[model samples]
Target: MAVQEHLIESQDRAAMIDPFVQLAFLNDAIDDLTAANLDLLDAEWFARYARSVDELTARLDAISIEARHRGHDRHCGFFSTKAWIKHHVQLTGSDAHGRIQTMRMFDLLPTWAAAARSGEVGVAQTRLMARVAANPRVHVGLLKCVESLLVDAIVLPYDEFERRIRDFQRSADQTGAETQARLNHAARDAMMRQKADGSWILWATFGSLQGAQVNEVLAHFIQAEWETDWAEARNRCGDDATLSDLQRSEPQRRADAAAAVFLAAASAPGDRRAPLPTLNIVIDDTTAEVIVSGGRLDAARYNKMICHTQNGDPIDCSEAAAIALWGHIRRVVRDASGVVIDMGRRSRLFTGAARQAVLLLSDRCLWPGCDRPNRNCEADHSLGWKAHGNTVPWNGGTMCRAHNRLKETGNFSARRQANGSWTIHDNDGEPIG
Candidate 1:
């Protein structure tokens, strides 16, 4: 309650010098709580504690919105308030954005904000309501219905409440719901990135039509694999294996089938973006070892050669060997001084293989926090080619069309650092993270 009072006071003092100083007080309060005997608390005590914390969070959300309104975030040297919250509060980017968005919706719907403050509607449920309220096409009458339910009910399961809200949306405006579904479909994407420990993670989202097609293909492969597994199980167990015992877990089977689908698709000829699959590696000649992107190849890693991707995710030699099966290798020769002597280059603007190389190297748009894939980006000279910049590996990076225009308008400047990172400056000469 004292912390909630402090948060309310902070709003009136929005011009307070060094907003980060208030953050330090909040951190100290959190540390004090962490040092308390939370685990020893009983169930009822824990429930009450959680409720109080949720109320505190709601109040802080209001204060955060007020702070943003007064431009305190910018004065604190942050590019955006969301970025500031991510760094100072230690919340993930998505979580910070969600909090901001929820508060904005609360400002629009006062009744829901009051309910959240009173702990009638929970923090999670409030956020969900905020999301539903964000749909511009949803009639105000639907929100009024939700608000009345919140004010009258003691407690409603969040899932059921969400369903009721959706029912309202569908009944009130089926056309809008269909149009929103189409918009969501247009945002489908996939990402493959390696982790720090040499393993890879794949994340993907698909539209309804595309997802149905993929599911159909995966089902065919799954059935085939399932039958093979079943036969093997029966052979090994003779009389013991049951129908359930014959099959692998659904997730494992699906993973295997997906890999099969991809490998088969790769081998099959079709229209493609890049002519060949390629893996880029930096290696040191002296120790016959792989070199990391930034650090020189001379650095020792447990007295053995080490390798990693441009993003600094480690990989072993065997993995590189596996990739070579699908892709041809290109060599970069260096002189005795460890300077690259030849990289197979020609034109002023990177095209074909060269453009592909830049895309693969950058992985995404060079603009900070702009996750637009390199496939959607245009190759740009980090140093203007008109100013004598060469079309070489070290001089070229990928920029999405929007960011490229910002560069052309002199609002942003970018340069490749020796460590392979891009140094970007805003119009005011401030560095953006």
Candidate 2:
């Protein structure tokens, strides 16, 4: 009798507490947090605080989903849920649509939704997952492997996680991937328009393979300009040279490179046509075998297959195999550590095939968060030539010119690990990433 009476009393108290009151309490807590001194907080505290915020955001999203289902927007005299959100939250139309789409994704992915509500997953990761889930061809497969994908989302870096999702999409729906590739090729377009100021603006889009080819030629010309800038900066500023000392800004160099390309094309001999740029497509044995056999492999094997351009853009397996037939294919051998063990002969400096091998080993500059393409980077000696570092691919890593100069200053250091990844450190001996 006493237990029943206590339960009734608890139910009455719960019924008395309004949602607006709960929100008011939440606002008060946020005010306290905003007033707290951040200087006294540590990294762990900040991480925990971010997770708490994520949890709250997830809860709000859940409430929004319920409101949409209940036709709350109609009751509030709004045409749609998105319009209601846009008017109330001061968000743009696109942003409001994105919120609605995310709500739908959460509805489809209950496991992920629960994890989000618990603060175990982040907004960025959830957004990426939602994007993959939106793909009609791979949606079912994504749902089947949500548990494993969730683990990857938690553990891998954002860039790698994105790549992983792409791999999954390609492997799970090869036909869809190839069809999309063809559509992209069909949609290629370019236009140049002169502005009122007498300057011109060029806008263009190309399929992945064609874009890579165009970028390769541009990068070669840009590299020549980079060399000139380095020479001029050395002559003028000597040891204290910095990126600001360069003769041309990056955009200016790109424009110059474009002009050079046009002039070179106009001067071509005999046929009056420039030769096609060579593209380097890398494919692992597994992917090549699948292409040769004309049969799909299990998802696990397909996910592990490596097929991409040197610029790190994933290519459809069938498309890469077709390109391999006409292009010169060079074999690259790597050791168990994923280090390029053999490409060609070594020399005093990274040149010829050795230099090419270094570029092939990396898609971008070794510096964390630096997205400069490999062709625009210098092959740096990790241990320094004076320190007896060999001129082999194993001893070399790619770095942009500015970062190379920074490393030479001794204020920063970088080491290439056995896995062919770089570990960068600051002057204080703290790892940069």
Candidate 3:
């Protein structure tokens, strides 16, 4: 019986080796799957379908790589593999180029390719890995840690996984990262053009750090516009007001807010010193020493460093060092676990310096699925004041007015974790993702 089963398996494998057989099997499978009633499918079925699709995509990518290796494009009268793919696959130019690039990256990183083929990682995660692998300065070093990064890709959210990869690149090639930052800064430009219609077009480019600053200021102005719209809607329609009742569309509001920003800047008083925007830049001790002394650090030491904006956007350590020389810097110390060890004030309400510290630390509201910016959020006690929570930075969390009110009603709660992050729980004490 074992010999018969082995013979059958070998026969099946050999049959699949023929391209026509594979195509017939795929066509039949897709037709059967698509014939199913979509309303009858369960969550588990959808998940399994997605995984199968990803595995098939990986296999197709592998075939594309093999075709490129065999010079099939040249044989087909095409100059480049990308051009042939664009034509044959009916994909956009950019999509075809991206697909070709990703396939090439898979040839270089076998572990990632294996994981992709097995459906252990999805296409989005693999695309991010391909992007990192394309960087020459970090490509060789990144290959050494493919397994570890694969774990992150499988377990973490896409955004966090992207951050981890970027952090690795920065640590592996700090000089290259710094040079790129300098190039971006040098290339920054802004232009205003008047069209035939009486309206004007504004365009600008900024490096990561400077763009973050611009984004921060724009967020405040946008929030102000939102507040006005919300107030007007509530006043007109009371609690029945919906998003459609808003006075302006989102794009219109953003354009108005941009104009408001320019008007505010132009009208500012020249005699008095305007308050500069506060940007939180986190750096560890060793990296700070290296940046301050203009010295080089080993990759291991660089890996230990933490240098990024408050919103987790990594910037060049050298740029942070230069800013520290002329900017008013506030030192907030944290312990090994990233819990703030210093800077606490005694008060019932989160006020003044304490409030500023809370805003500086928080990028958005603590409530799950809430992306209300910290500037528009109110600082609240995770352990309520009535419950004897201390009025310290560690005890406080940021939440929007609506969510804060909901928490106050005792249907929800928040906890400040050891790493200075917040976890919100439902009325049943289940943690919300």
Candidate 4:
């Protein structure tokens, strides 16, 4: 009976190899599978296909490991299993390396290997487990325990699975996690390249902690910009027209917000590469220092000494006092009409206190979905000077160059509304879409 079972197993294995008996047969099989009626496949079919592929990948990895252990790579004139896999399978160096790492994980924990072969876990989830198991900081026994927990975690969503693994690792060894984090932080790098087409692309890798902080700042600006759509709705007195106002997608908002953060940081006084705006603290001569509206100190209580920038960002009173003591100060006085009565400087273009006043009122680029801080924007006339527009605060609005160009080319228009907010219009005279 045992001899008959061995013969059946051998025949089964031979039949599996029969279809891929040659390179042509394998290539034709792949082509045939690709040409199958994939559009008719349901979600269940997709899930099963994905799981089957993962299982096949595990079997391939096991075969590769066995071949390497048996010195087949040397016979094939390859220096390493990675090189062999890359040459034969057309995988990238990183993919080949990851395959070897997976094989190592399988060798260290047979249960994980079994689970991977059974399609109980996916390739990505298996990779995550492999990384955790291979952490030199984790003891062998602890990894065994982790490997077991991951068997249950295999059913979790990908993100949740990663989080659970991280939590487990952190709980098992806090010091090791910190050390790994430091290593990861040390590996961080950023590169910005301007393409020949005058477009810039940024590539960056950040440690988890810094990445979280960056995400928070981006989210804050994204949310702020998103909220402005509703603010416009309120300005329009809850008109149904605003249901589709300012059609920037969420991804675009996040991208613009990321750029705004970098611009904000570069505008700091300590950064001397460019002439950026300083924190303007408008104050009265009252020695008691009762706070008035405007500058960084707007809406502060008379008893308390909170200060603000012209753009209405709060600053520490000490920082405000230091700026007051030494920074360039140009007094800007506004009349009851809310027009700048005194700009303390004169130019064809709005500059100095006049520019600051416009920036303060505008708060951000007049362009919809642009959350660029006022300081980074240029002051522009909503109506062109050639069209009889003045350089006064009332005539001027804040805008980044891209939007200003649109207005210049007659593709965009901004009209001051009754409530002090500007109503942006497209070239067709429709509200900004």
Query: Across residues 3-55, which tens digit of lDDT does each residue of candidate 4 receive?
Result: 99999999998888743356577568779887888778787787788667666
Which candidate model has the greater TM-score, 1 or 3? 3
For candidate 1, report its TM-score: 0.37
Q: Which residue ranges in model 2 land beyond 4 Å of their true spot?
A: 1-22, 25-69, 72-80, 270-277, 301-303, 328-348, 380-396, 402-422, 425-430
Per-candidate RMSD, Å: 25.8, 4.8, 4.4, 18.7
List candidate 4 stretches off by more than 4 Å: 1-69, 73-77, 171-175, 183-207, 229-246, 249-251, 262-433
TM-score of each model, in listed order: 0.37, 0.79, 0.82, 0.46
Write one digit per residue (lDDT tens) for candidate 3, span 268-347.
98887847646777666677777789786445433345776665567677877777666743333333454453344457
Q: Model 1 misses residue 219 by how many Å?
A: 9.0
Q: Give the backbone clash total of model 3.
A: 0
Quick one: best TM-score, which candidate? 3
Candidate 2 lDDT over 335-373, as tens digits, reads 234455454234567877677877877778888878888
Model 3: how far residue 58 lies from native, Å: 6.9
Candidate order, lDDT descending: 2, 3, 4, 1
Clash-forming residue pairs, model 4: 247-433, 295-309, 296-307, 296-308, 296-309, 297-308
For all candidates in order, the CA lDDT equals 0.60, 0.75, 0.75, 0.61
Residue lDDT tens for model 1, 93-124: 88888867776677777777676665556666
